[model samples]
Target chain A: MKTIQKQAQALLCNSLLASAVAVIFATSALADELNYSNKLLLTGGVSQVEGAAGGGLTPWAVIGGYGTNNEVGGSVHYTYVKTGDYKLDTYGFTIGLFDRVEFSVAEQSFDLGKLRNKVTAGLGADVFGRNQLTQTIVGLKVRVAGEAILDADTWMPQIAVGLQYKDNDETDFIKSAVIGAKSDHGTDVYVSATKLLLAQNLLLNGTLRLTKANQFGLLGFGGDKHDSYQPMLELSAAYLLRKDLAIGAEYRMKPDNLRSPANDLLFGGANVVDLKEDDAFDVFIAYAPTKNISLTAAYVNLGNIATVKAVGADYGNQEGVYLSAQIGF
Target chain B: MNINIKAATAALLATATFLMAQPAIAEVYAQNPNLGNTPMEGTATFEAFGGKEGLVKIMDDFMIGLVADPRTKPFFDNNKQTFIKAMLVEQMCELMNGGCKYPGRDMKASHANMKVNREGFNALVEQFQFAMDKHNVPFSAQNKLLAKLAPMYREIETTTGDAVPPVFPKAE
Candidate 1:
């Protein structure tokens, strides 16, 4: 499975290269007809961790690029997050068509570091040996109603519906009796509404998601304790300081799918370390030096992931730095 | 034809009733004192642009930038640039509450034949921002004025296709 996923990642890279070449050739031929930079600066939002066009945490209703209603635009992004006990690296690309539909693909690698040793000692060497968990997310979004920019004069907002299918590579470990995950794959559905109040230089977004994944699907989907879909809410607010700069904060509610009685007994015996999942929050600053590129840096807190009482694996209330860079048309 | 006219009349009446029923419509109308919207409150926003004279200089640079940018040059080059600049000055002055009344026609009537599109509109906005930055206008003040003008895109953009500059009859 790891080799297959590696091959898939290689294929994704090759396809991205092919698409970039195609875009270059297409641009010269359709330069006059297709409008490239029709949307205002920073209005398309930056690429989120899961390859969506949004803030650092959750997807917004706006499309992924600077395209207007009559043009096509896209972006490529890389994000890095370092926490007290783990490090996550994400890279992805998105294609937005006619400012109405968005298609995205992302690959995330979560490095467990020293925690791998603790898990191996507790659950036996054969149960867990890998130092990292890798997952691929493929997403699709469609603008359902309203316009974030054109309808700025009114109270209307842009609304969109999106879906993400996540596949984790660590199938055997996830299905083991220790982890007890029902599956290594799952799907998430969400609806988002975003409004850009230009008069006040403010942007607000709200997203409602239904999912069964644990730790954003990095720890696989479902579990022995709870396997049903749960609804989560995410919110973001941003203030435009300048045409090229914005500051924002986000809060994302997550489901505690792995903290049931059975799972707690296995991972946190005698209440050594409660394995309850907590919400995620972040405050970010995004800067666009030019229309072609943007940079985002944030302080993020991703609360508790599989806490076990050990020398170096007490991963609770994780706080870290998030950095991302995006390049697009 | 008679039925079609009657249906149109009914639709117009329904729209009128809907507009009249909304209490917020009254405030919107009252706020819109002129085509440029009501003058902004307080003199601080006005002074930030260096007052009326400062606006004139900004308009000059704005027109020059318009003519130089490839995306917007076709619309301003060889057109009635001096008159357009004067109208812009008056519009900005009135919007900033600088004690000036804009004498030009409303936005829709003036831009009816320009065939403007999203690309052209955005280009014009970029050039305008560049001009304001050149004049050292405060960014916040620029945004306040932009907030007032951004909605005018509804009246200015007439098509989704490529922008086509209207050709005025040559002076005899």
Candidate 2:
């Protein structure tokens, strides 16, 4: 399993490098014919952790690149997040077509420091030795109604529907026994509405998602407690201070499906590990010095991931700083 | 050609009626009060541009920028440069409710012959922004005016192809 994991990582690194080279060549070769970048700067939102165009935590309705109706565009992004107990690194790329459709792929590697140590100590070192969990997400979105930018005078907002398929790399025993996961993969479907009140220099977005993933599919999908898909609401609001600078806040609801009292009875409730999930939020400032580059820094609050009473390990409400950078046409 | 005369006649009749109603208010008669988008609610925005004098200054720089920008040069480097600049100033002044009215064709009728694309339209807007910046217009005031003009893209951009400037006979 370790060898397979190493090989998969190596393969992924090689493919990413190749794709980067190909994207650079394609952009330069088709500079005149494609990717006109007619849209205004920063109109294409920064890439989200799941590779969608949006604010820090939630996906907005805008496409992922600065493409207008007659052009194609794309972007690449890297995000780093650190909490009191863990760290997350995400990298992704997205392609936008004619300002209507978007396709994205992202990889998230979550380093579980205290949780890994506690679990390994409790279950013995040989049972679970991995220090991190990784997941791959592929996303597709299509704009269905209205225009966020040109419709500045109207109440109508841009609406889009999208889906993300997530696959986690984890052993069956670790998923089923440690996290009580029913599956290692799942899909999340969402619909988003975004409005840019150009006169007020404000942008607002709301999204409703149907998902069954646990901890964004890093701990796997579904759960022993509740296995049905649930609706989660996400919201983002941004105020443009200048043409190239914006400050925003986001709130994303998360499902609590891993806390099972029934499973606790198996251990006579003596060593129950509470897995109640909490909603996430962030306050961010994004700045673009040029059309091709954007940087974002945020204060993120992702409440306690899990707590193990048996090991006396309580991962306090995890709050930390998040930083992201993006480069694109 | 006949349609142009007819439209002109209709506009003149409308202007006559408007003049009779507010006889003492306007120094310059107009073809249509509707030439600009809905007039802004308050005089504060008009005052922000220093009234008509400020608009003239902005338009002067704006025309130069338009002619210099490669993407928009074809559209503005024409024989009717003075007329176009005057129309823009009047349109913006009336939009801000500065006691002025525009005597120009509406957005669609005027740009009908030009095949304006998104790229060209955006380029024009960028140049206009530069002109406003050069004249030290307050950013918020600039945005207020932009919000009124931004929707004109619907009427101005009529094609996905490269923009082609319309040819007009020089004034006799």
Taking the tens digit of each residue's C-alpha lDDT, what string does model 2 give over A1-329?
75597578647855974696478447845654543346687889999888899998888899987667777788888999998888999988888988899988888989886676786787676444677888788899999877777666666778889999987877464365567788888999988888888878889888877788877888787776678887777889999887789999998877777754434656765536777778889999999987678999999998867677666677758899999998776
Colliding pairs, model 2 = none
Q: What local lDDT does model 1 show for residue B60?
A: 93
DockQ of 2: 0.14
Candidate 1 CAPRI assessment class: incorrect
DockQ of each model vs. true complex: 0.15, 0.14
Candidate with the greatest TM-score versus the true structure: 1
Best by DockQ: 1
lDDT for each residue of candidate 1 in A255-299, tens digit (9 for 90 to 100): 766643434655454544345667899999999997767999999
Poorest 10 consecutive residues by lDDT, candidate 1 chain B: B18-27
Instruction: Please identify model 2 stretches exceeding 4 Å from their true place.
Output: A1-17, A24-36, A121-126, A171-174, A260-266, B1-36, B168-172
Question: Model 2 misses residue B112 by how many Å?
Answer: 0.7
How much TM-score does chain B earn in each model? 0.79, 0.77
Per-residue lDDT of A201 in model 2? 84
